[model samples]
Structures are given as structure tokens and as C-alpha cells.
Target: MVTADRRQGRRRADPPPRRRRLPESPPPPPRSARTWTWTWGTLLVVAALAVLLLGRTDVLPLVAQRGAAVVLTTLYGVALAVRTGGRPVISGALCLVLGVAGVALAEPILLSGLVVLTGVVSAVLGVMLTLPAATFPGVVREVLVAVVVAAAGALAIEGYAAEVSRERLAYVVLALSLAGALLLVFRLGAGLHGLGRRGSVILAAGLGAVTVTLAYTEALRRWASPGLLGAFESFVAQVDATLGGVPQPLAILLGFPALAWGVSMRARRRQGWWVCAFGVAATGPLAVALASVGLVTAGFSLLYSLLAGLVVGYGVIRLDQFLTGPRGRRARQLEAASAHRPEPRRTAPVL
Candidate 1:
């Protein structure tokens, strides 16, 4: 008859369902993030060194630095807006007026703090807006890392500047060392893309301009007659007061990196134009920071800006050549072939 098994109407209970283990996604390779971190970190370190050199020599005054910070933050916002295809020139102008008014009305310490806070917020917004929508999260993480690194670098520079306040030679040595480091970093970047002879020349010229400008400014400060220096100082002070202490020199200094980046991008045409544009735009903040810290003066800034403009213009011309040169020929051929392609005949539509 029906055995116990038959009575149960079932064989052994189905085995418990196996839990399928998913292969843990390999921790995302951090190459891209690390590269961005290093790039931004190096840039900040270089900026800190510049500030220290300028501040120790009284080139970057507190009032100038404050004004510069506000200006830079505004420029960064404008740059971000431009990159995102939004026209914020009017907004930027309005922000600048408001910043100047705020500076005029607020206490020095309070204004400085407010500017710093605004800079932080602007930096975050700029990064967020500049990144692609598809990869926003990864970009945000990288930007945060960069900000932390840059902040740490700035703090270290400030401490070092204080420590070496009395040591003129120490400042000189430190400036030279930082300059060398920057050169090495840029040389490496150039090397990565195999800069051609023309590229090398452009790079050398840019580096030389930076070096010469720094040396000239330092020399003018150190060796000029006390009468001359005093006259210059008075003039600078007047300018600062007239402009509400917004230093133009730092703005020019900020333009150098942009000019250099544009040259490099032109040297390697495969890179995006937007990247070069962004790099140039990003300098507005650095320029402000330098001004805030007393790393640049009005006269030198104007001179540097002129030189940087020349260099960037040259780079743009070179890039245009590529578009109109042999490469353009190949592109034209492709377009011609596509234009000549025949359309397939379709049967008349049935009524």
C-alpha cells in the first residue's frame, strides 16, 4: 500500500535555494582620481609658494589679498558658467560690484572670513557645474580630494612663511626650489605628450617668462633706491585704494597658467579646447589668492598679463593652423566623400 514516503507525497524536501554570490566589483581603479589629485595638488603647492614669496616681500598686502579673493571667486563662477554654455558676464559684473561694496562696508577680518566662505562655496559649485552629468559623482569625489589637498598645502605654506619671516635668503631659496619643482612637473607633462620642437620652444618661452618676471619683481623690490621704492609703494597704495585693494598683478599671474595650458593643448591637438579654456578660466581664483597673500603687485601683474596674452594668442593661432593645415585636408576629403554618397531609391508609397 502507500508507504510512508508515498503517504508524504513527496521525495526529500527540495534543497534550500543556493545563494548566488556576486563577484565583488573590483574597487574602481583610482588612476583617474589620483591623476586629478596630483595635478591639483601640485598646482596648489606652486600657488602657495608664490604667495609665500610675494607675502614675505610685502608685495601682496592684506587689503589687496582680500579684494583679490573676491574677484577670483567671481571670475571662477563666471568661468564655470561660460563652460556650461551659460552667459554669466552680467551676473559676474553684479557680483563684483556687490563684493566691492561689501568690502567697503565690512570690517577687514569679517570681510576676509566672508570672502573665504564665498570662495569655498563657489569652488564647490564651479566643480559641480563643470563636470559632465554622466560622471558627476566621480568628479565630485576627485574635486573634494583636490580641495583637501590644496587646503593642506596652503596651510603648510602659511606656516612656512611665518617661520621664515626674518630669513631673506631662506625665502629666495624656497622660491627657487618651488620654481624648479614647477618646471619639472610641467616638463613631465610636456614629455608625456611628446612636445615637438615648436612646442618645446613655446614651453621654454612660457617658463622663461615666468622665471624672468619673478626675478625682475624681486630684484626691483630688493635693489631699487629707497626713494624709488617709496614712490612705487605710494603709487601702488593709491591704486589699491582706488580699486578697493583689488590687485591686478595677481590676476595677470593667474593668467600665466592658462596661457601655458593653452600652449600645451595646441601642441597636442587631440586634447579638447574646453580643457584649455577651463584651465585658463580656473586661474582667476589663484590670481585672487596670490593677491590676497601679497604675492603680486599691480605693475608686475599688468606686465605678466600682457606677456601671457601674447603667449595664449600665439597658441590659439597655432591651433587654428592645425584646423586649416594638412589635417584639414583629410577632413575635407571625408566630407566630400560623404556628400557624394548616393541616397537609396524607395518604392512609391501605395495609395
Candidate 2:
């Protein structure tokens, strides 16, 4: 009876309904997806091998060969995307459209478009094939994958008869590769907030070094006095003659070390991806190295780069150990077990 007066004043509010409990994390991918991914990768590799071997022969028409190459390269990119956290169906559909367009634009008249597509494909393959590793040996394994992918991309780009300047092609490929890699790394590292003070400084310094090198080279080429330009070219020629070719500065100085240290860091933290993004400096130039320099010089150059880069990577690993790893050998071993958590399998989606 008294409740009637209470209702007139203000009825008691009902408690909000309990919301459904959400998952702590997304479920792992189905077994079928992983199996299909491996199947597709194997088939694509075989197809690519066949094309590379038979590409010069009359067994397949030139147009058909190039078309197959473009499609295969694009499909590999889609597979990489899926393995690196992309939706399989969507990436597949989008890559399919791009592949068709690439095949259609295979004519000499449309060479520029093909060059652009080649750059896109190479960048995608270069960046997506990489993952943060736990040790220097793992980083070396990743580098090998990058080398193979780049070589395949180089072959595909070289299939066309028309030639764009090597400098222009290299620049395009590097720029696109850097952009895509940075974007992916941003997501992988959990955005700007994830980059603590040390990470920010390291990333900034690395970027500055890369930018200055690129800018200085371009300026010397385009704006330096004729005498200076000639002198530079002469020096480069002498170096090439003496050493086959010097290791790429970008790869030796920054890319490989960053990859090594970043992966080591990833064993403890996510911010390592920010550093690893610079690895494209090595892989980007690699994609166009063969196309620009010819087989023998490119081979020697890559060999030198690998050796120098490994040396740098080793130094980086030791420095990281000094800074952050445990005090003694035994402690370090125990710390490694505690800090270096297991990651997803190489062929699985990391995210």
C-alpha cells in the first residue's frame, strides 16, 4: 500500500541485463585453412619453377608465360598476407583482380603499368614474408626467404622486353616496400603507444640514416657539378671492378642489425617490430638488384651484403645481451626460457 506512494515518487530502476561474456582472444584458425595454405604454397612454387625453367623456350607462348608469372607472384603475395593476419577470402579476391589486370596489361604498350604492378607485387612479397624471430639464426632463415622471394620477383619483372631505367625501378620498389612494411609494422607493434622512449629514438635514428643516404645519392646524381659526378662515377666503377660490387650500405649498416636486434627484442616485447620494419632496406634493393646489375655482379653483391650484414647482426645481438639479458651465462639461459615465449608456427597467422 505504501509502495503506491513510492512508485508515484520514483520507481526503483531495474538492474541492467548482464552482457554476454566475450572471448579473451580470437580462436585459432581452423586446420583446413592451414592445410590449404600449405597446399597452395607448394603448388605455386612448382608452377613458378616450371615457368622459370621453361620461360625461354617456345613450349609456352611469351604472353602466356608472363601472364603465368604475374599471376603466380600475385598469388604468393595473397598467401603471405593470409599468413600474416589478413583475411584469406578477401585477400585472395583482391589479388585475383590485380592478377587479371596485370595479365591484361602485359603488352609492351602498357609496360609502365606493368612496372608499377611489379613494384607492388615485390613490395608485398618482401614485407609479408618476414616475421620477428627469436635468435640470430632465425633471422638468417628469414633473410633467405626474402632473397628467394626477391629473386622470383626480379625474374617476373624482367620478363617484359621494354626497359625502364634501373635507378627509377629501384627507387620505386624501395619506396613502396618501405611504405608497406612500415604500415604492417605499425599494426604488428600495436601502434605508436607501443613504441616506448627507447624504441622511438631507435626508429627515428634509423629512419634518419636511411633518408640521408638516399637523399645524398640522389643529389649527387642529379645536382652535383659535372666534375664531381664524374669523379663519383669513376670511384664507383673502380669499386665495382675491384670488389665485384660493395655490399649495399643500407643493408649492412641498418637493415640486418635492426632485424637481428628487433627479433631478439621481440622475444621479450612487441616493439621489436618497429625496428624490424627497416629490414625492407635490404630486401627492397635485392628485388631489383639482379635486374639492374646483371647476374654475376648481383650475385657477388648479395654475397658480400649477406656476410657484412651477418657481422653487423652478430654485434647487435651481443650489444642487446649486454644491455638487457641476464648477468651470467646460466642466468641468461634461464631468462631466455622465461622471456622468449613461443610464437605461432612460421606458416600460421601471428595475429
Candidate 3:
């Protein structure tokens, strides 16, 4: 081996280090998938719009109009599933067949005890679809989107104006929504395997709240003495008159807080999925806001409930931050060091 001379122009400068290239992000969904989504989405919107206009003009017969509404709502649910990274063509076709059968057998199913079952299942789906967010504002935005989607679903099912007593249509739409949301969340939550101890507790609590509330309400209606029932009704009426509308207690107490905290937790842990499941208390009621009450009454109730729930949600967030967040004089530094990982966009597939 030849040795270099120490005096040779200060030992020629070392070659510059090769520049390191950061890994590139994964490519977006295929072009064909995007094209299919856009095309299918546009078609659905146009068809739904046409149905709405014709129904308003009374050009479509009542039975046909209701049937069309159910189909459109089912299609909307299929679109929601596609948004969750499903194979659009396959899932859409399968759901369409089920939707047709639903329309044909709606009356028979309605006469059964589908209302309660549909309500609970749809509520669970509503909460799951809300997903998780990285920030408070992000959570709020997601909640708003959930509300808008629920409202659209409600509108799709309200095709029979004269048959005001037919609440079964709403349950059908709820069933469709439940089916779509479940298809994705089942995978996202990693099914039962992912629900560890904490997740199990949260889920149990959520189900308990919903079940107990429903049982209590039904019991009050069916078994309470007339005097007690009248007193309760009077109290509710008085509260409604005084406050313009009474907010749903479930929403204010459980749904909003659980959602806010759950999303915040999801930024840190998967257990957030369990907590988010409780958010259905709010979303489920909001889904049928128009169906359960008059337009004006629904509007007022929703406004009050939303405002109050946000306040409670904010409190829950603060409490969570206080309990689990960084502390001490170096808190800001700790937070900076523990910056959150980036999340996918709202419309993007999270799993």
C-alpha cells in the first residue's frame, strides 16, 4: 500500500458526503378509483336532486316516491362505505340488492320491533363514523360533517308527507347507515381483538348509557301512573316553553364529551375508538332531529344541544389535558418534542 505524503497540499480535501434522500410518501389512490368515485358521486347527487324536485312537484306517485327515496338513501350509504376505502363497484352492487329487498319488505319489517333495534345500531354507527381528530377544531369539524350527513339521510327518508305516522322509513334509512359505517369501522378498530381492556370498558359504558336511557323512557311511557306521567309531561312542557327547546340529556352528558376526549386520545392511543363510540348519543338523536319533531322545534333543539354539548366537550378536553398532558416549567418544550403525527384528510381512508 502506498502512503500519502503529509505535506502534499494539506492532504487533498475529502470528497463531499453523498446527499441523503428522504423516503417519498406512498402514492395516492389509483387514478381509476378516483375517476370512478367522482363519476358515481356525481350521478348519485343528480339523481337525488331530481327525485327531490319531482317529489316536491308531486309528479311522482307516493309509493314510487317513497321507494325511490329508500333506494337513494341506500345508495348514499354505499357511497359512504366507498369513502371508507371499499371497492366501489362490488360494494355498491351488493348494497343495492339489499336496498331493493328493504323497500319491498318495509311494511312487514316495520310492523316488527325494528324501530328500537335500528335506533341503537344506527347510533353506534353514527359515533363510529365520526372517527378521530388531532385537534379540537378538527374534532368540531368532523362532528359538523357527521351532523350534515345525518341530516341528508333524514331528508332522503322523509318522502311521505301525508303518512306522518310512518316512522318506519326513518329506521330503514338508519339501518342502511349502520350497514355502511360498520363495514369500515370493523376493520379500523381491528374488530374485537383491538378492543383491549380500556376499549372494552368504554364500550360497555356507552352501551349501558344507551340501553338504560331507552329502558327508562319506555318504562315511563308504559308503566308510570297517570298522575306521574302527567307531572313529567308538564315538567317537560314547562322546560320546553321556558328554554324554547329542551336539549337531549344523553347528548350533553355522554356523546359530546366522549367524542371530544376520544378524538384527542386517538391522537395518542387506539383506545380512543371505544370512547368515540359513545358519541352516538348525540349523533343518533341528531340524525332524526327532523323526524322526531317539527322543523322549527328540531332546529331550536339542535342549536341548544350543540351549544351545550360543545361547552361540556371543551371541559372534558381541558380535564384530560390537565390529567395526562405535560406539566412543569418545561411543558411547552415537552409538547413541542411530542408533536402529534399527521392524520389523513377527513374524506380519506384512515385505515
- lDDT digits (tens) for residues 1-351 of candidate 3: 134565454456666679999999999779689778768765875676467547656798766655555555555545555556666567556545654565566664441223332333345434545655666787787667555555544444455332333334433433443343444555766787788876777677766776687678768878999999999989989988887777777778876777777776776666676566566666665655554565567668877877788889889877766776776647834663464645554445556
Estimate, for each residue in 230-324, the C-alpha lDDT of model 1 and write its tens digit: 99989977866665344334224433333333333333342222222223222324323332343244334434444554445345544644664
Q: lDDT tens string, model 2, 210-229?
A: 88988988988889999998
Regions more than 4 Å wrong, model 2 = 1-29, 53-61, 105-110
Worst 10 residues of 2 by lDDT: 107-116
Tell me the whole-model lDDT of each prediction, alpha carbons only: 0.41, 0.72, 0.61
Report the backbone clash tally of model 1: 4
lDDT of 1 at 217: 71
Q: lDDT of candidate 3 vs native?
A: 0.61
TM-score of 3: 0.71
- TM per prediction: 0.37, 0.82, 0.71
Q: Which candidate's TM-score is highest?
A: 2
What RMSD does each model have against the real structure?
Answer: 16.8, 4.5, 8.7
- Give the number of the best model, judged by lDDT: 2
Q: What's the C-alpha lDDT at position 234 in model 1?
A: 95
